[model samples]
Target: MNMPVLTSLRRRFAALAVLIASLPGAADAQADPAATFTALRAVDQRMATIAYRLTTANAPLCRGLVPVPGWAVHSLGQYDPAMRDQARTSFGFEAPIAVEAVVAGAPAARAGVVANDSILAVNGQPLRGAPGAKADSNARDAAQAVIARQPAAAALRVELVRGGARRTVAIAAPAGCPGSFEVLLGPGMDASADGSIVQIAVRFFERYTDDQVAVVVAHELAHNILRHRARLDAAKVSRGLLAEVGRNGRLFRQTETEADLLGMHLLRNAGYDPQLAVAFWRDHGGDVDGGLFRSRTHPSSKARAQAIADEIARIPAGSPRPYLPPLLATRDTPLQ
Candidate 1:
């Protein structure tokens, strides 16, 4: 449809969404009946904030080709935050991590991997053995090997679980040099013609702060696991949360939500405290561009936080944490 028709449709959805969320009384879900209305209004305000953050969070994670405004022109991955430091050495991997750049027009992009997707394990083998200063680069090398060994131009199947579903997708890659895979962490990121492979500019997960990096890596990993890039390609257009603003907005939001769900699973599977995903985003200090009644492509920051908490509650506690400090020994130890 044309511009006017699309605008009218979006307006219609906005109206319907309010009713569907039954949000007017959301304030009434307060601690007490007397404070119910007051609390509800607070909830409303917070929800509005969350909405803007959602869109901001999807920036670099979304298909790099989308022209949506970025939190920055480049979303570089650095261990700038304490959380990132904490996530390192926490995964208890017995091997070194291997990092790889995604090849443009290759299967990895089709798989939705950002520059930061931490290949903690390959074929169920951890990266502790890869060998390197960080030991993490081994995982990257291992991943390259996996790709190299695969039949060229063949459809490769990758498994990832998103939300409550395990999603699998096949990507036909250029054969021979898996080493040809190139990746950028921030603005350097690029997308392939078919939208399968992507070059990300950073690697936040490599920063290493236990649950913190787990959340970061898991989020990026989710993009590939959920086939978000492919989904974006399928969607001819989307406009941020106003998805009304651009043809690709709705697609952007949907891919983000899908990735969030899948990312949650990756974190859980990797043996990190899944709840930290929520905490990490809370501390992430996202951009809140939209004003009242404005929306984002991804779920509100509040929603992202809540969804993560919800997912964590459902995951059966998995293997024990591999790299945690001795709890009993350090419980009351002085902070050195």
Candidate 2:
């Protein structure tokens, strides 16, 4: 009996060592601050691009989907001077909005807008000021403000420079949801949706590919679309910490399953392989709880992986519907 106990103890210690190594800090050494910020911003840019693509692609299939100008723009040097200099050199012009990407079949693409085109002005208002990061932000804000004020299918004039040649083109805006996304610089695999905004962690972004990131973003967006956050707050499930934890855990586990389903639809609509969702969750799900134990707040990694597989099978490839299942929440158990 004593010998058996000693062997079991040794195996348990080894397992703990593996688990400890996988934790955020132990797994990867601390990253340089500048490098981390740069990486986060890249994720921010990509998320903005993907979110716009997914929402716009599915707009016609879903109701109340408003489309904005279908283009991706970004500014540089928000935190560091080196980034700004890099942007100027990369684009060969110091413009406020750098057209990083244009969605195919979108208004901008139809207008022959190409990547590396530096946006000079919108609606005849010459965009010029400080080339600082704030100026870059202001430029984007002005563009969005202009878009917000326009009617659906309205034509807007955009002045841009390609290969140092100035040209003005007209782009018609589409209707899409007013929701947007941002990235948070932090450790750990965390994401959330609060009605209108989807926040993704940089650590998570660094760990996954764009397709994997899409699954997470789509899931969070699903939460917002289903109004889970507001419903949870309204339920007032519990005031005590332990009580809230138990109630929320149970509720979120259910919502997690639903998000996995809806996220697949979003991914399909956006032209990303829905199968990647299954791969991502399966590979990383086990890491969530370390070993065999699964939390109430989320289904077991095995269960989640299987759920994604099931969902993928249910939704036919190349035919996606922007339909979300009705989420009916009881008084105590919120859908989220």
TM-score of each: 0.36, 0.65
Tens digits of lDDT, candidate 2, 259-325: 6767777787678887877877788866534436554566777787798788777654554355443
The worst-scoring run of ten residues by lDDT in candidate 2 lies at 1-10
Tell how far residue 157 is off in model 1, in angstroms: 23
Count: clashes, candidate 2: 6
True-structure RMSD, every candidate:
22.5, 11.0
Which runs of model 1 end up more than 4 angstroms from their true locations? Answer: 1-147, 151-210, 239-248, 285-295, 316-336
Highest TM-score among the candidates is held by which one?
Answer: 2
Cα error, residue 54 of model 1, in Å, equals 24
- Clashes counted in candidate 1 amount to 65
How high is the lDDT of residue 139 in model 2? 50
User: Tens digits of per-residue lDDT for model 1 on 228-292?
Assistant: 55445455454333464554555565556555655655554444455677786655514221223
